[model samples]
Target: MNSNNSVFGQTLAQVHSKFIIVQVLVVIFLCVNLLLIVTFFKNECFYTTTRYILFAVTLLSDSFLFLASDFIFIFNIFRVTMQVSLCSVSCIIVGLYLIVTPVTLTAMTLERYVAICMPLRHAELCSTHSSVHVILVIHGLSSVPYAVIFITFFASASLDFYYQYRTCSVEIFFLYKWQDHVKSAVFQFYFLIMCLIIMLCYFKIMKVARTASGDDKISSRKGLRTVTLHAFQLLLCLIQFWYPLITSSLIHIDFTDLQHVRFFCYIMFNLAPRCLSPLIYGLRDEMFLHALRRCLSCGLYETK
Candidate 1:
């Protein structure tokens, strides 16, 4: 018993250390995002109340996930009951945010698509009022799957476990036989449909851009860059996060069987996208690059 207890203690210590590292990285990512938001708001060109609201919503959702994960990590240290509750709430919020963000991304893509591919219709179609309404509708649609998952999971009383150092996962739903098949099918279907929509929209935009002529060289380049950034984002999204989770689900393997590998992968996957996003935007967005330089120069001037 003493030997076993010592081994467990060592394992917990290692896991706790990893969790602390992830927390620190998450904080850094949030700070970067906050800076971007401030820079965005300060720029009059980018100031639209609708965009501000969307930014706020995304930040709030991301913060919830961060906080919830932090709580779970801290709670693990003491083996408290509250961890389970935090896990449930965190899972629901994270799941909802996951769904909502893709919709936002899709809308943002369409916004860029219109600005490049259909410049004449851009202002009329993507006015502030229209964008706000579209955002609301997108969020409403996204909430449906999360709501179903939350209700079903909670109602079934399957959220009782508070595993130490384990991140809350979608695979927890699969423990129930009915939820297992239902969620698997739903996820597969949704992923396929989303991929198809994204492909179709992108192809159409590219086709339109190719036919147009004149000083659209800049616009065409921007359009392609936006699509590439989004593609990279999607690649990271799938390979790092969704792919691992999906693999775990499809294999029907015991979570404990590959526990450490999954945890490490999750940490790397989640952190990579957050860090990569800012870098990609900085590289691809001339406006953002200009803003960054201006901010840096202003800071230097103030210091001097």
Candidate 2:
């Protein structure tokens, strides 16, 4: 019995350490995202550009996603249960933002395509007002699946379901086994559409990159690289969709291996993709980088 107790203690220690490492990484990324967000606002130049606007939306949504999901993660670690309604709200927010990131990446790719391929109409077509409208549409569409699922659950479940306490995870919201299949279908459908959109944008940008001259060619090439990074980030999101299946298979093979796989997936596929947006835009864009530095210096000066 003491041997079993020792094994349990070791397992608990390992789990806590893993949770701390993940939490630290998320906090670091969140701080970087917040800094970039402040930089965006400080630079009035970003206000008029559609790309910057969309990027700001990505940062905002991703920040919220990290916060909400991390709360759930920490709660799971401590075995903290909450009211079903509250947990559902948190899970819905988490789901909404997960869909938003990839969809926004797709939109950003399309924006680049328009900027490079159709330079003349880019300003008019991809204006600030239009970008905001696109953002609203993205959120609206992303909310549909989760909203439908929740509505179905509430409609069918007893009123006691609302009052009941439960651990907050996506599984708690699942009303039926069919919901899993529906989720897989939604993820697959989204992946297909996003893949096609990014690929089309990439090829279009590539053609422009080959034919254009001097500054236009340089701009086209830059846009091509940006779209490629977006595609990679979207791929990470796609991998996250399959993470559960991967972990589930690992279960029968070895429980210890399953935990490792889960941790690896959570970091690489989940948190790392969220980290890319700032790296892509904040570090890569010279203008944004300059503005970020300026903001940071000013912040330090004020503090001093």
Index of the highest-TM-score prediction: 2
Q: Write the per-residue lDDT of candidate 1 for residues 186-230, one digit (tens) a residue.
A: 556666665666676688777766876776865776677776666
lDDT of each: 0.62, 0.85
Off by over 4 Å in 1: 1-13, 49-60, 73-86, 158-175, 238-257, 296-304
* lDDT assessment of candidate 1: 0.62
Q: State the displacement of the C-alpha of residue 47, model 1, in Å, after optimal TM-score superposition.
A: 2.1
Count the clashes in each prediction: 0, 0
Query: Which residue ranges in model 2 land beyond 4 Å of their true spot?
Result: 247-259, 299-304
**What local lDDT does model 1 show for residue 6?**
100
Clashing pairs in 2: none
Q: What is the TM-score of each predicted model, taking all chains together?
A: 0.78, 0.93
